[model samples]
Target: MSWGIEIYEKGMPIKITGRSFIFDQIAVTQNGSKTYNNIPKGRSLAAYIVARNRGSYFTVKVENNKISWNSLRGSQSINGIIMVLIK
Candidate 1:
């Protein structure tokens, strides 16, 4: 069994811990940014890159509710898994 954290909201239990209170996966666009408004119950944001195309690098940015991925060093294309964790 795994352990996490929760809080009571008006006598109801609300899960707010473990593996990032909330997690969202978004696809990378060759160029541009995407906005996500479903804010999770947490105080931090974490992101990871899972590259699909060999020898491709990207610069990822998370600002407010926006996530942007751009090919770096003239990479022809950008393809990968953007793991977003709100915790």
Candidate 2:
């Protein structure tokens, strides 16, 4: 049995869109031990942020197929767009 989910079939880019408030965090976990290729490492994942609140910062962490993100700011709701390239 395999719990792995293929985010991309041809190693294409996937775009994810969401909204977040200050101090809000998001976590995405792949349901298997298999890891995707071309996944950014550690804080470098922030580079995948296509659009976010100005003056705000994003914290990203990737371990295996799990990804966590924290939106940092004092007070504000922001729309976040992230593009992930999977191989």
Candidate 3:
């Protein structure tokens, strides 16, 4: 995961939002595999978890504003693409 203030979706090319985190020293892991390094976990505005499927490329964006991790059902997915936004 990269860090700064901008986050981009894989293959999308465009940043997700103005508050997206785009940094050079962030740690990103996929399917339990480390993908990036030194990810910031203490930023108040930073997203704690950003998960993207390697196969389908579906992305999950989780911010730190909320105090709960909502549940998502696998059946809710469309085209096997499931994107979860947690806050």
- In candidate 1, stretches whose alpha carbon ends up further than 4 angstroms from where it belongs are 1-22
Residue 32's lDDT in candidate 3: 21
Name the better of 1 and 2 by TM-score: 1
Model 3 poorest ten-residue lDDT run = 78-87
Backbone clash count, each prediction separately: 0, 0, 9
lDDT of 1 by residue, 37-69 (tens): 777545556555644467677877888777777
* TM-score of every candidate relative to the true structure: 0.64, 0.37, 0.21
Writing each residue's lDDT as its tens digit, candidate 2 over 49-83 gives 44554665655556555554555553444455444
So what's the TM-score on candidate 3?
0.21
Clashing pairs in model 1? none
- Candidates in descending TM-score order: 1, 2, 3
CA lDDT of 64 in candidate 1?
Answer: 77
Better of 1 and 3 by TM-score: 1
